[model samples]
Structure formats: structure tokens, C-alpha cells
Target chain A: MVHRISLVGETFVFQDLKHILASASLLRSGDELAGIAARDPVERVAAREVLANLPLRHFLTEAIVPYETDEVTRLIMDSHDEAAFTPISHMTVGQFRDWLLSYAADTSSLEKLSPGLTPEMVAAVSKLMRNQDLVSVGRKMRVVSAFRNTQGLPARLGSRLQPNHPTDDPDGISAALLDGLLLGAGDAVLGINPASDHIGRGMDILWRFDDIRQRFDMPVQSCLLTHVTNTITMIEKGAPVDLVFQSIAGSEQANSGFGISLGILSEAWQAARELNRGTVGTNVMYFETGQGSALSSGTHHGVDQQTMEVRAYAVARVYSPLLVNTVVGFIGPEYLYDGKQIIRAGLEDHFCGKLLGLPMGCDVCYTNHAETDQDDMDTLMMLLTAAGVNFLIAVPGGDDVMLSYQSLSYHDILTLRSVFGVRPAPEFEAWLERMALVDGTRLRMNQPYALPNFRAGS
Target chain B: MSQLAQDPWGPLRRYTHARIGLPRTGDSIAGSEVRALQAAHACARRAVHACLDPAKLAVGDSFIEVRSQAKDRSEFVRRPDLGRRLDGPSIALLKQIAPAGPWDVVLVAADGLSAVAVERQAPPLQNAVRAALAHTWRIAPLVVAHNARVALGDEIGALLGVRCVVMMIGERPGLSVSDSLSLYMTWNPHVGRQDSERNCISNIHARGLSTGEGCHKLCWLLKSARKLGYTGVALKDESTNMTLLPETKTP
Candidate 1:
């Protein structure tokens, strides 16, 4: 006989009884129980009575069966007694498994469930799920949303400007900026990594990008990829700073190598908050992380790369950053030797970061020395797009000369949109349409436009 | 350096290229400090995108200039595989130059991430190593390969039938020093050898390892490698013991 028992608040004795009945062939599978639950009132009541009357256990063999043996399940039950996730934790493994399958079938339930759910609880439940189930769950949990200027992200796939020139020359910088914008890129942020450690040059680059952004009337934010202290100094100097950037490692020692502490990060966040430069609301920090950074900085603390990465997310979550991206394949071949390892790390970082309630993106990139190519990047990009990545770094042609690596390009953004039917952030899309760069959700670049006359030849 | 302008942290900055203590004015950085950082940043950027000019490198006409399979700087940055081997015509040229029995060593200079590094640091370092090893080794013609990576030396060495290959390539540009070159020496050089199979000597620049010191270290390692018949992790640098003697002292 099939029965859908409401397992909530059921004692251990009752669970033991249910298991004993199942083992003795008295009970059917969860699907059958769900079917019985769908039946008329009389059949459902009869099925419940049959389940309740079953013998608790056969004591003659002295075989002891325990439901709390699985550590993950026990932890879930103990931690999830609060109102938000209690219903999920109280479910039997079979029932929870069935619910997970149903949830995967229709992920719109995630928006309904997200309010009460913490990423930790989601992570706990995820331990019982399969790979496909994790993907579906990851695709639905839009915990953090970013709005740069007027462009709201994670509502659509957003792209960042990575115009890395060797010198922070205004003319050279302007050319790359115009090129990227002409190809319909950088809706997320205009980010630059200066080769110089000078606070003034970094500030100059920030001011230049902001000026160009204003001239074009583009609703984009500008970031200078410098140390947090330098960014703070620039803000004090009255430089137009939108977002502060830092590379964070997992362990304490590694972060120390970057001259950062949790205290310092909080200070930077506070500094940016006080400036309040952007049109968008606060959350004006950007962080980039990767595997092997901890080990490289002599601060791994004997932790594995993936765990260290997740711990790094906890640090990132503190800032409520507008963006937190993992440069998956950029570390080198030593840690992630090939494309296969790179792809796996990207998905894991994305899934874990999303679970931790961070706006996650993946810089699908690789150094030339590694055994990876454009095809590998495409595979990771498509999977990340499917997994609902918030943003990606968009360079001119996938070649970053200054950084000495390859990343996503303008064409890659278009490819993701055409292949996955993903659009730019809603506001950015409207801007694209207004500029006639796209037609009814389709990106179209029939002609190259001339550079604006405001700063002609600089 | 003015006493007033000196960093309060003292000589700590001298030991590393990383930016550390700087003199400050009130709550802001001093003007001189800002300009110094700007200068360093400009140099690094110039090195990252600079092209190699064989004539300016002035390693002499005996060195045959060759191009890797990568057609340009952008292609070289994007496709690392192309930078690790010679083009078909360049391969034919290598065959024409040295067609037979293995020589003791083949030295190559490649413009890696920083062409300025190769141009500035490679000549003095290469000359010192050659002068030291002139008696013991039959070295092949010096190869100046444009748009090449470290592994490109392996193919050149294999085609020329050399016992070992040493490539002096530009290291990635750091904000503190853009013109830093690195040496990678591989024993029994051939294609498909992993990076772990090579021994590296890094930070060969004005502020780091001087050309004379770099040559001494390179010569000691090369001789030890020739004796041990390998150059990777198996061969450790015992050159420190050699430098302990008074006669081998570096100035």
C-alpha cells in the first residue's frame, strides 16, 4: 500500500517504523506514495492507516538501523529548525529527493523559496542532489543583483570592459574604449588594471573612463584595478571613483600578501560608500579570485583549492560587491592543468558562490602556456551561461596583452546571446536599441561609427 | 634620496620590487611618490606591447633571426602553441644552418611578454655566459627568435642537434620592474618537454641579479647540467658553494 506520510515533527520511532515497512515490501516507492496522495479522500485515509499500523521493527535479528548515521542529513535537521527551512529539513530523504526533482522540473519555485533560504541551507540540501539537480538549483538562485549606473545585471548577461593597455595613455585608452562600446560591450563596468602602482596614474585612468562614459552618455561604471588603499587615496583626492577592485585569496596569509585584511576591506567598502559616486545604489566593490592564489602566496593552510575558494567567497560576501568573478583558467597549468579541470573549477566556483549569496561571474580565460584553447573557453562560457552567470570579462578579441592571457571577446557576448537567447541587462539593452546597435533583441553592427569629436585625437 | 623624503620603513623597499612604504603629505601621497609610480607603470606598459627589433638588440650578424609560427603580437598572446614552435620556413632555415651531429649547447633569445627585457638585459648576460664557456663547449649560432615563447628553443635545439638549450626570454612585466629577463635551461632539448623539465633563473635585471652574477650562476648550472645530463628539479643549484671561494667572488 502507498501512503504519503507527513513526516514533519515525526519522532525517530515513527521514521524507524516507516523504514521497516518499506524494507518488508509493505510500502511502495515515493512516486507511488505521491500518486496515492493525489487520490480521493477515502483511499488516502485508508493508505495512511495501513502505514501507521505496520510493525516498527523486527527485533529478533537484533539488527539496528539508524536514520541519523548520515552526517549531512543530521546536520540539516539540527540546523534547519528555524521557520524558513524547517519544512525542507523535516522531509524524508525520499520525499526531499522527489521535491528536488520537481523543483528542478520547474525552477520558478526558487524565487518563492529564496526569501527564507540561506545559501548554507541550500548547500546542505545540495549534498543530497545530483549534478543536474545542482545545475538547476544554481540556475535559479539569483541572490544578488548588480546595477551599474542604470544597467541592472543578473536580470540579463552582463559584460565588463577589459581594455588593458600597457601605458595608461588617454589616446590609446580612448581607442580601445570606443572599439569595445562600438561592438556593444562593457555594460557591467569599465574596468582597467594599471601596470603602474602609482595612485595618480590609476586615478587618471579612472577619470578618463568616466569622462568617456559621460561623453557617450553610456550608463556604465568605471573601475581602476588597484589596491584598496590606493583606491581610498584616489577617493580622498576627489578622483571620480565608482568601484574599488582587489584580488583576494582564500587564506589569511595570502590575503596579507595582497596587503589586505578583513578590516582593510571593510575600510575600503566604507570609503567607497562615503564617496557614493555612481548612479546605482551602494555595493561599489569588485573582487577577483582564483585557485592556487592561496598556495602561491604561502597561505593555503593545508586546505584544498575548492574549499579555499568557497572561504574566499565568504570574504567577498562581506563587501556586498557589485561583482565577484573567478579567473578560472588564468592561474596556470600547475593547479588546473588542462581545459577539463578548468571547466570543472568554473562550475564549482559559480555554484558555491551562488550558494553563498554572491553575484558570481566567471572569467573564462587561460594563459598560453596552459593546454587550453578557444573551444575550451566556449564550453565553459556556455555552461556558465546555462548556470546563470551574472557577467563576464569582454576584451577586444580575446587577447589581453597587458595581462598576458586570453579571455572572452565582443564576439563571444554576441555568441552567447544568439545561442542561449540571453540578452544584455534590461537598461543596457534599451541603450543598445536606442543606439541602433541591436534590433528587437538581436545585436546588429552593420557599420562602424566614427569616434565622437569631444576629444578628437586627444 | 633626501632624508626628509626617505620612507620611514627604511631599506625594506630595497629588498623587493613590490610597492611598500612611501612618504606621505598629510592624508595624501607626496607629488614625487606619485610621479615615480607613474613612471614605473609607463615602463611596464611599454614593455608589455613593445616589439623586438633585431638590429637594436645588436647580438651580432652571426645570430640568425627567426620568427615563431605566431604571425604577430596579438596572435602570439592568444595562441601560445604557435609561439612554442618555428614556422615551416624557419624550420627549413634551421636545417640549412646546422644539419647534423649534436653540439654542446645552443643559446636562444626570445621576446616573451616583454621585448624591452630581451633588448635591455639579454646581450650583456649572453656575452658573459659565452665568454665563460668558450673553452669547454661547442656552442651553435645564437638564435634571435621573434614572438617566441620559452618552448620555442626546444624545437630549435632539436633541429640543430644540440645537447642542451638555454633560452633567455622576457618575464612577465611587474609594476616595479618591466625590463626583467629570465633564463630557462633544458638538457637534451627536444619538443613536447613539459615546463617542469626545465630549470629557471629569474630576476636577471639591473636591480636584481647583475649580468656578471647571472652569467656565473648560468655557467655553474650549465656545467653541472652537462655532468648530470639533466637540468630540472633533479639538478639543484650548488653554485652557492662555488661562490663561497674567494677567486669566484662577484663584484
Candidate 2:
């Protein structure tokens, strides 16, 4: 059976759960819903009624731990006063504590009845220890979502790196030159590791802040922020902007020693929230692709490994959960689609299965130049959409220009008008006056129109 | 100084010249010197074509022949797609030779640049393929392409939709010899792919990596990739020294 446990409440249950809870009489340390609900008589009466009607063990097994199995049957039979175990019997703050205390004392019984109790129970209880942390994360995701929406408008009002020779110029996003093809997409633009030893390079770039301000008209605060050892603290200060560019290749090398570390996401999300409180518009960009770049052909590069595709998939699987965090929207080094059957298979398994529950409005970035065409773009979009990518750094004018560039296709615009009660962008009176419709509904391209900055985040 | 330093491919430009083993034309140089370049080029092309054509070649869209002419005639473009498809006759030939659909993996070799390398390496590669297939593995339809590169295997794999693909391609002919082979592998078929996705087994030749040793390594890689689902960047073959393979003799 697949074991799915939250990381939140694990530690307390494993280490000193019974000891800590007994000493700390206060069940709700700081204003959890259980504490408030306990004080309300009306809610308590309703809960008692439901509990009395419902089978207590059934609810506990389904909600608390699905694999209680034989433990539930054994626990009920062992209890001498089986009538006391009725659902209507209210578990008061004290009674709940006593019951837990009794449960902990019967560890020997638990072990005897359930042979799989020792390590597995420890792991399950350990997972529940992170519940305190989960509450904070849930609240933070909600707040960051609101903040991301609020910062959306004011930030889009200005320009970014200049368009012409945009890739050449480090800061050419604002004054875009020809079209959306300037830097290709966000991932391709920011995913490059041009400077080796990023922390030192970041310091070098930070030192040149005065020169950068003089050279470009960007805001004084619009500096690039990278995740160094002290990145979270740096984000709080609101000086250098943040860019999360961890090397997938480097991480793949680490997989041998460190079996999948999921704590990195919580740490990054916590850090982003801390920084968001101080800074209004976000200057953070995420990049975690290009895991296969480090594989050498024939020559051993010190790492004992099998093939490149394995490393890429390993890296993706490790980082999949972290993608759900609100701070991260950009992802790339999207070289997995390269016509290698093995690598593609791994990508399908890991990416398709593991990556769900992505934060709404997340964008996928492709870092390196795959020279991807329309068909490639379509496949990538379908894959990302399935993986829950709402926003993407699409190839401008590459696929259907209407969907990619204008964010509206003929069918979509018509559907919006008829079904959703929304009109097309060109349907505005001023826009209609300026634009000409050729084929009844579709607007024919006559004069060139500059792309309105559709960057979602601040 | 930085531009000079960054030019990794600079030293290779001088490596380009007419190959050896052709009849004396005495066009550019006197006697033996003129004949040497011609011979080398002829030998290289012959070797490449010999391995590629006989063992089934597929370009982009379909399978091809050792010495087939394009009906469209404009197919000699530098781009990937133009030279991918094979003519009807070559496709018919491939259909006869190619195994049925949904193979676990396929092995393909291409002339790429030097046919001499293909000729020299084909026997060892065949030996390796036999050794791998001896395990009763479900093998895919292997095909050859005319002009190719390392990631060209990715393109072929993508087009074919095989489970795994390993393409043995000709390395650029060097002064020492023209018959050097490189092996590239991927999990699923991907065409028009890049370097950062797949793994490679390169310099598999009599001089560098013995064909037997290359075969052993490829087998090991194929097994691991199948088990783990992907390979290339994460595979570290630091176990036994490849140079110490019992069958290998230094050229």
C-alpha cells in the first residue's frame, strides 16, 4: 500500500509526543481551531451528536490513519468498558489527553497485535509532527497569492530588459525590440548559468549596482537576487532581487548520499514569505533544469552513475514537490523532450505522476535553446498544462500567434463572448476603430502592434 | 585573450582535409600526396556506407540506402529534416528487414562523417549488439541515417517511438584514423533533441575504447537506464577501468 503522510506532525509523535503533550496541558498552544471549537458549547453539542451517531473507530481510521486495520479491532476489544467508546461520548480536553496517554502506554500491546507497528508507526507519527508547520505554510500560500495578484498591475506598467540584443544585454527585458522572440521565454532568458560560482558572481554584480543604475533606467531596487547561503535574509532586506537557479546536474550528484530532500521547498517558501512582507513587487525568478549537462561521454567525471537520463529524472523527481510552492513559477533546462526514448520515459513517469497541486498561475521556462518548433511547443504546453501550469513563457509568434502572443484564440474569444459573457480585446470601441476585421470575425494583421507586457508577477 | 581562450573548437578546423585511399589524380599535390587524401576520403566514405546501408538506415521520416539518390534533389540541405526521409525503394527494403513494432530498444549506426570508422567499428558493434540481444531482450527496429550527429539518435528515436535508442555514429575523422565511433542513448524516441538530455558512449574504437569494452559498457548502461527509467547525466561508470578490458589491445 502507498503511504502518504504529511511532514508536519511527524517529529513530535516520534521523539517526545506523549511526554510533551502531558506536560503542556494546553492542547492548542496558540489559537488553533480545535482550541476555539472546544470552548463553544453549541459546536461541542453538535460534534457530540455526530460522534454518537457515527462509528468512532471508522471515522478515526479513515481520517487519522487508513492503515489502522487490525489495530482498530484489537483496540476496541481490549478496552474493558466498550460502552465508553461510544461516538456520543465527548472526548474532552482532559479525556483526550488521558486517552492519548493510555494509548502511548500500551505501546507493547500495539507492537504485539500489529507486527508492522514498530518502524512504520514511528514514521507515521513522525510525519504528523510537521502539522504545526503545515498550518503556517497554508496561511502563507494564501497571503502570497493575494500579494502576487495585488502587485500584478502596478509592475506591468513599466518596461524591463530592452528588446534589441536583449540576450546580449543583461538588462534588455523592458524595451523589447522585434517581438516576444527577444529572449525566447522567461526560462531561456534567466536559466543561463553564464557565470560560474554564482554567489561570487552575484557579489560582483551587486558591487556594480551604481554602474548598473547609471547604465540602465531600471529602478534602484531592481537588482538580481540569487539563492546564496544567506538568500532568505537577503530577500527580507529588499536590495538585490532574487533568482532561484539551482543546478539539476549538481543535485543529481547529491542523490546518492541524500535520498530526496523535500525540506528545501518549505525553507524556500518560508523565505519568500519573509521577503514578500518587506518588498512589494517580486524580483524573484525560479530555474531548476539542465540536470543532464554534466554527463561526460566515456570519461568518468568522478561521479559513479549510469546515464544522463537517469540523472535528469532523479533531479526532477526530487524537486517536483518544491514546484508547488508559491515562490517558484519558472522551471527549465527543458531538454527532457530530446528524442531519447529512455530520458522521455523517465520524464513521463516522474513529471506526469509526481507534479500535481502546482500553485495557480505558475509559468514553465525552457532554459537552453532546443530550437523548438510549433509541434514541440504544442507538446510541451500540453504536458505542462497536465502538470498544472497555468502561465507559461510561450514561444511568441511561434505557434498560433493569437493564443501565444495575444492570449486569445478565435474560438476562445468567441467562446468567452457567448459562454462566459466576455468580449475580445479588439472589441473595445477604440480598438475596433483602430483595427480592421477581414474574415467576418478574425482581425487580419495589417499594422504591427507592440506586445503589451503580460508578465504576471511583480 | 578571452576570445582565443574560449575557442574550444578552433584546433579542429585544421583537422578538416580530404581523406586517404584513392587513386592518384595528381590534381593538387604531386603523386603520393594527392593520392593519399583521395584514398583516405574514399576509404572513410566506403566504410561508413558499408555499415550503414547493409544494416538498415533511417534518416528522419523513413529508412534509406547506402547509395540512394533523392527524388526531390534539393534534400542536401544542412538542416535536419531535409535528409530525414528515405525514398520508396529504400523504405520497402527496410520493411523487409525491420522487426515488428514496439521494440524495447533499437541500435542504429550512421556514416556521419567518416565511413572508415564505421567499417572498422561495425564488427565490434555487431558483436556488442549480439551480446546484448543474447539476453532475449525485445529489440527495436534499427535504421541508419545519411548525414548525422550525436543527438540525431534522439530525432530518430522520437520519430520511431521506441522504448530506448542507442545510435552509434562516426566521430569526425582525425589525422590518426577516420574510423572512430560514438554511442548515444535515450529512454524514449525523441527527434531534434539537444545534448543536455541523453547520455553518450564516445571514442569507441580500436585505438581508444575497444568494441568489446564499449559493448559491455552499453549493455550495462541499457540495463541501468531501463531499471531507473533514464540515464546520461547521472550515470557514472567509474567501476572497472575500461582500458583494462581483456579483449582490448592498444593500437
Candidate 3:
């Protein structure tokens, strides 16, 4: 169905729902590169106006990617909650936006509406909203999930201490992990992006994280960013697989490009939960996503990057993920282009993920070539924190040596915690207190550092 | 880098290349740290936009130069699909230089994201491959693709009707290592093949995967892929456990 709208005496027509979604996106290079962006700024606004009038149920009836071909579309259509949708059943996308902002839609109301909302519906409504609107609404909804400690609590910001090593060196990773842990980070988890694809290396790193957590008796878990299949294989080898991690995308073809499927993820998920490693709760999956991934893999299906990105949240929410992060700038300047575009995509991703009732975090990051710098990251980190982002990925100096990108550093995590008056997850805070790392909720800057067995042991 | 003041955390730099424990003034890293980071970014940014000097790229080497469908660097960065295929003239050039039937493998080098990596690393890797496979396999002429991505190899190989394609391209330039190269090998070389259908060996640099070690794995993969009739997920590089090379630096 071609949607038409006249703006300032010029008529703009979008060929289909996907076209409307694509053209209405906050100007991103990925859409333009996909050749689906609006002809001009006027058409963008025109498309947004058309999208705002469409009822939320229209998304349920019309899928951007056909349900016959894509399992992700099938998941979205088949899993939508009709009962939860009844309150805003008659509302247009614009009305839904107002409802999101209204006093009636608090945390509980948003929770009730979470399963009712599909990615397409949320992506459509987001096009009509600005950065502040996205933040204001997203800040209201809290998506609490847990494993060793609770995440997504209000007035709390969890963080993953990403102690990545270029060569998966035990001493190197141990040193980075030691630094991050000393700064009172890693309340979310201690994760690493191993340089080698060999499962032995991934398993070796996992052992190191597990050993660190066990020896310190810290309220944290361990994860290695390897393939889901590798994690499943590790599980068979009796490796301590705390959270099964994978990079997911919007399309079936894109997921295929990663050599993963819903079935494969399910197998890994089952294997992880069967380990029964959680001390507090049982949310076992951790997923990382980014916009333009589908486009990068040549499986975008003409959908805009942001919409494609929001679709991944639908997939994440299905598995009851403990953590879902969007590596906002890691795809580089090709998709996002500059700091302005990266910042916009970051806010949109966080807001949309929260709306889906998934524990949303942002990898407030940029590539060196992406026309963004540390200052832009600092700005995005501050904004995302205020928007009630569940967590943030904090590497040692925001420089991820293994991944070849800059992310929010461990020091940035300290800044966010201090500036926003937020603390790490409660159980982790208690653990830090026992270690004399905290002085009444504030991290002690001058503590005597002693991890004698860190570099050499286990 | 102030004349009198030095980085207090300098001793901790031994374990990793990651910049950690940077000194902060007021929620921001010190200006010295920022400048150090800027220097790294400057080189990386230059690597992204740097043009491949053909004379320097092919020194005492007869490289059949070609260009991707992307007209220039800007289009090459944005339009990945265009960079994956050859231009009209490039296609014509490849067709003219090749035989009708299949060869064992075709090799193509590309200045992908980092011209420094290609100019510095690809020649030695090419020599190593030629030395390893000259007697065993029917190799095609080395093609130098400008403004290219990994899949450009498939197009050149398909035009030559080769069994496999070895794409040597620049990996994205990181701060610590700007001139790292990557190798991608695909059997049944053709258009529209997924990245999952190929095997990759990235981070070929002085500090990372050594040239000798890279060749060892490549020979093993080429032999296995030919026997197995594929090169992706089904094939795994277990070269580390095998005692083939005299000294192997396990990544």
C-alpha cells in the first residue's frame, strides 16, 4: 500500500510500509546507501507525517520482510500480545507517542504494553519523536533482568568491564581486568573479546575470568565474545559459560551471514541455562547488536538501518536476555557517517530497546575514521545515562585493542556513576564494600591495590 | 608529553597495547593522553583515505591492475556492493588475460581501508604464496584491485574460472596497528556468495600473524578446501596443533 502525504504543496509517496519506515528515519548514511532514503528533507518530514497517522495494528498486518521467508518476522507476528495491546488498540502511531509521554504510561503500564508493541510499530513511532522525546519516554520504562545480580534498576547503572586483549594474552587481559575492577566497574559482567577464533583461546580466557571472579569472590560472571556454537561447544567441555553471547541482526539472511539461526541460539541458550550458574536470577543470554549490520552483510531487504536495528530487539526480548547492547558506532562511518548520526542512532537504539522490555545498554563508541572522537562519546554516554540506559560497555581506556575501536572507558563509567548519582548493581556494590573498594557508595580512589595471584595464577 | 611531567602509569603498559589507567583532570583524560590518542587516530584516518601509489604498490612486479565498480574512495567506502564487483574495463581486462577453463586458484590484492597495509604486507605474502604453490597449482596472474573489498576476488576469479580465490586486503586500521593485512579464501568463487562461505585469516602484521605462519595455514586450508570442496564453517584451521612449520606463533 502506497502512503501519500502533501507537505508545503508537494505530494510525497512511499511505496510500502518499509519505504515509509526507511524514508522517515532520522537521516542516516545507511538508508541513503541502501537507496531508500527520502529524496529531500521535505520528503522525510512528509513520510513521518504519513507514518504518524497509521494505526499500530497496521504493522501487525503488514510486515516489512515477508513472514514466509523470515523467522524474525514470524517471531514478531506470532508472539505479539493482543490483550496487552488493547489499551492503545485504536491509537495511531502519533497517538501512541503521546501515550508514551502521558502520565498514564509509567513503568507498570509500559511493562504491560511491552509485548504488545512490535519493532515496526516502535520504529514508526520513533520517527515522529526527537532525541529528547526518545529519552523522556525511554527513561520511564525499566527493563529489569538478572543473573548473578539484578540489572536495569532505576538509580543504578551496570557496566561490563571489557578487558579485551589483542592476542588473548592471559597476563595482558588479567592486567586490564585488574585495572577495571579496581575502578569499581564490571558489576554487570567481566567480558572479553578474544582476538583468536580458536575455541581453546576463548575457553582459556573464560577460565581466567572465572578464576578472577572466584578468587575475589566477586558478585560477577564471566563471558567470552565468541560464536554461539563455540559457547555450546565450550559448555560440553565443562567450561564456565555464564552468559551465551552472539551478534544478532534483523534479517534471517543477515543472521545466516553470522552463521547462526534461531535454532542455533536456542541450543546455546538451553546449554547455558542447563549449567545453572546464576546465583540470583536466570536470565542467561547476552546479545550485542548494531545498526547497519544487515546492510553490511548485504541482507537489509531495503529496510532502513534503524528499523532493522529495532527488529533485533524483538529477537533479543524473545530469549529473555540478561543484557542487550548496541555497539552504536562499531559499524563505522559507512553507515552512521559522523558524530551527529552516531549520537542519533545511539539514542534511538536505547529508547527502542527499552520499549521492547529488554535490558538495553549502549556501547558508546566510535571508530577513529568515523568523524567522531572522545568528546562525542562523552556526550553520548551522558545522554544515554540520563535516558536510563541499563548499562554501558566500559573498556580500559575506551580503546578496545582487540576490536579496533574506542568505547566508553572504565573512567567514563566512574564519571557516569558520579554525575548521575547512580551506583552499580546492588549485589555488586555490597561485594565492593566488603573488598574495601567503596567508601559509602563512592569508589575509593586511593585503595592499596593487591591482587598477587592475578597475573600468574589459574 | 610535558617536559617535566611523565605518565605515572607508564610501568603498566607492558601487559597490553590498550591504553588503560589514563590520568584525568576533571572527568576527562589529560591533554597528553588525548594527544597520544589523536596521533593514533591521525594515522588511522590517513590509512582510510590514503591512495594506493601503483608504482610503489607493484615494485618489480607485473600486477594486472584493475578497479572496482566504485569510481573513487568515497564511493568505495559507502557502497560496499560496488566495491565487491569489478568495473566494466576491469572485467574486460581480466577476461582478456585469463584462459577459458578453470585454474587451481586466482590471487587478487586490494587496498581495502588501508593502503599502507596492502603496500607493505601484500607483496611479501604474494611471494610466499607463489613459492608455496608454484609447482602444485595452476595460478592466475596477480591482479591489483584499487578501491576494493574482499569479494572483489570472487569476481576476478569467476572471470578466470578458477577453483578458488585468495583475497589479500587491508584490515581496518586500529590505533595500535594501522598496517595489518587480512587474507580471505573462498572455493567455488562466484558472485553473491555470503561471507560465511569463506575462511578468513586477519591481523597479518609484525606483531600478529607472522608471514611464515600465515602461509602454513593457507597451504593447509587450500589443500583441505580443495578436498572438501568448500572453505567456510565446515573447514577449521587446526594448524596450531600440527607440527609442520619450524616455529609457529600461535595467535
**Stretches of candidate 3 exceeding 4 Å from the true structure:** A196-204, A229-238, A251-276, A439-442, A446-448, A451-458, B1-14, B24-28, B58-64, B92-109, B123-142, B157-166, B184-201, B209-251
Alpha-carbon lDDT, every model: 0.67, 0.35, 0.86
State residue A277's C-alpha deviation in candidate 2, in Å: 9.0
Show pairs that collide, candidate 1: A166-B45, A196-B41
True contacts kept of each: 0.00, 0.00, 0.54
List, residue by residue over A145-171, the lDDT tens digit for candidate 1.
554543324447888978777666655
Q: Model 1, which residues run further than 4 Å from truth? A: A1-131, A149-155, A446-451, A454-456, B1-125, B128-251
Candidates ranked, most accurate by lDDT first: 3, 1, 2
Count of backbone collisions in candidate 2 = 79
Deviation from native of the Cα of residue A326 in model 2, angstroms: 12
Please give the C-alpha DockQ score of model 2. Answer: 0.03
DockQ of each: 0.03, 0.03, 0.37
lDDT of each residue in A239-353, candidate 2, tens digit only? 3433433333222224222222325534654565445422233433332322223322221122212122222332333222222111111111121222131223222222211
Best by lDDT: 3
Predicted chain A of candidate 1: TM-score: 0.75
